[model samples]
Target: MVFDAPPATASHSWMPSSPCGPACIEPIDEIGTARTLARLAGVIGLVLSFPVLTAATPKARREHMQRRYARTALRCLGLRLRIVDHRHEPVDGFAAPDTGVLVVAGHIGWADVLALAAVQPVGFVARADMVDWPVLGTLAKLTRVIPIERARLRELPGVVDRIARRLADGQRVAVFPEGTTWCGRAYGSLRPALFQAAIDTATPVQPVRLRYLDGDGNPCTVPAFVGTDTFGDSARRVLRSKGMTVEIVLEPRQWPGTDRRDLARRCADAVRGTDPSRHGLLDTEWIAAGSTRVQDPSVGERGPIRRTVMATRW
Candidate 1:
């Protein structure tokens, strides 16, 4: 179903506009009709089961089930999840941290949400309308997503305060600072407002780089849910795509300094890598090689150490 685009206002002036459209999506190998149908069936079953499974579960077990459900959802879409960690300390398994972390990433599509949750299930800062979306809406409520009304700019501070409270309570929260989606090929600048939450709580900001790649490790834009494309449009493209992989690169966590703008820039630099291009788009050649160097200038850090975690498919 086609979703109504939020009306533009002066408050949204800071939001970036992309030149990307349907033409940006590269042609890729696709699975057959039968396989695609089966994948769709699998996804439907999982979506239907999600609320029932988590309705009565405790917080800890519920989180575990959420991660499992997310990973399974990706698999059903014929996608593989590959995680590259650059942090000094990385933990295994799904465990809530003693302290909270602000997880930031470049927004690509709706699948970006599932991919992040699959790695480490965390609450999200999503568009308010998402809570009203059918089955997905129920799932959103179950995950406790923090909804922000883009049209109501005045409510942003309240949203920021809510994020800060979550962090203070030692809960990991994720936000796409760009405030919109981009094709995997290019991305917009990270907006500074949400970074204030991390600053207020003195929490570390985790910058994650997400990419959709084909089987041969080349960029794939088939999954991009941008422009006027409906949810069904994106879902069909993803389900039919073959050997599509979602690559998640975890950059070193940046400790919040006093300035939220500076912190946003640093986190943006980490997510965008050292690519010296407008909109921070990576060089196609570098992306295909499956490598990129992310350096945080504020911390005088050179680059992150590469650690790959190949998630086992269930």
Candidate 2:
């Protein structure tokens, strides 16, 4: 299978049905176990040497390999990533920066990290438990991912400090502001402290919303790593599904100085499909205010797809 770099234009003709009920569908079928395992094996074989190369190779070459590792892993897993940027700008590489860009995204599953890593190499805020994850944990440490000890609240400050230092050192860092995971429909607040780091450094905050879907366009729930779901189980679910595609929307990013709570709300609203650019207020706010639908700016009206997935209002 072949993978394409993000397209130059941002066009989401596949509009989703008004955000579905808060309940996310989780598919549990044993149909594609063999194929999934086969794909997993291929990815493992390709990445087994990552640790060795990371230490031995030069900085630029090492980062290149890491990205190739992610892209190759996604392809082997049969997940297609489609990125839509309203600005239509190309993805940026973390070559070096005075204060790196702070990237925030909605948390869906662990796979979400892999998909984003495929697009650009960003150091992420991971949980402490990941340190015990076999190959993955080791790789995360080698790649310089910042870990947070969720159990000890005091440790958070240290984690934040580390994240700030990472940013100061010119590394693009990705964080899931919800502070937790849930179905794709609903979202939690974007933690405020991290946003402050951007403010201190005068760096930009880019919000990228990610949703996994099927070729038919409906949201794909098979891969959600939610309650009672094991890593193995989620991997099998993804492998068994007909096929999976990821829709990544690069929202209009804002700089620091914006209220953290307000920024979080704006990010949530956009990720939830009520784009602030075209719509006046959040869709929910409008709905609660007694309006059924926030009138979309009369521009390009795309015909509905045959049971297709909805890309956020773009």
Name the candidate that leads on TM-score: 1
Q: What digit string (tens of lDDT, one per residue) describes model 1 on residues 1-314?
A: 22443312224543334434555567699889999999999988998888788887787677777788999999998999998888777464222455688999988888898999998888999988787664457778888999987667778899999999999999889998877676777666677889999999998888998889998998788888766666767778998999989999888889999998789889988998875332223223222111222221123332432323221110
- What are the C-alpha RMSDs, in order, of all predicted structures? 10.1, 11.6
**After superposing candidate 2, which stretches have Cα over 4 Å from the reference?**
1-23, 28-31, 88-99, 275-314
TM-score of 1: 0.83
RMSD after Cα superposition, model 1: 10.1
lDDT of 2 by residue, 253-298 (tens): 7666657656655656656556222111123322221112222222
Clashing pairs in 2: 15-310, 16-310, 217-308, 217-309
Stretch of 10 with least lDDT, candidate 2: 1-10
